[model samples]
Target: MNMNKREKIYLIAIIVLLGLLLAKSFYLDEYKPVTEDEILFREYVEKVIDDKFHGFFSRSKLIGYRIVSIKKVEDEGVSVIEVKSENEGEYKNAEIDGKYVAKIRKYLFHVLPYGEDKILSRK
Candidate 1:
């Protein structure tokens, strides 16, 4: 069946709107409520990362710390989390200070450092 000119225009407009909505869902961050289990997990993970950060920088003081994001590892019972932090300290004669980022893996109740800490800034 041949659609009228106006009908064709409307169809195209509707499709474009639908496409935009789908793209937005993938590109934007949707609001997700914090759940009880997620809260507990985050608190536990934060403590684990905090200890590791301090241990890695013995004389450093962590000024700020946060978990950037958490993602599940395939079908496993493990999660990979990204952490961002800022700290300052003195080592030898030089001052160590910077913003840092790290990824860690959590399985059950155990947490493991995943990779090297990335220094975002230092002077």
Candidate 2:
């Protein structure tokens, strides 16, 4: 290809501008503001726990459950919520010293923010 000085300068400017644009896009995307809905998050966690332990535990036992912390993690461009909960209760067949003992049970849950109905893990 035949090019003059003006053409060469224009081409260089275009390349530099494109590079800057690309960099700006990446920077903006990386720091994009994320929306966190506390109510929705809590509701989702409760619904998940209820659905999983519905007939397994008495209502009284589950009533003591409370969320300890909720954190948002970004992995592979996906928004994941990590929830930690603690409850003081006695489960069926769980006895210590020949008697049911009240103990703290920790629960961990991983949820996807894309859809509140999607739960990644529960422990």
Which portions of model 1 miss their true places by more than 4 Å? 1-33, 56-59, 74-123
lDDT score for residue 68 of model 1: 45
Q: Best TM-score goes to which candidate?
A: 2
RMSD of each: 16.0, 18.8
| Per-residue lDDT of model 2, residues 29-113, tens digit only | 2222223434344444555566565553335453233343344432233323333334433222111111111112222221111
Give the per-residue lDDT digits (tens) of candidate 1, residues 1-123. 999999999999999987775554334322222644344344445655556656433334313233544432233233333333334332122112222222343221112222333222111
Q: How much lDDT does candidate 2 score?
A: 0.38
**Highest lDDT, which number?**
1
Clashing pairs in 1: none
Model 2 poorest ten-residue lDDT run: 94-103
lDDT of 2 at 48: 55
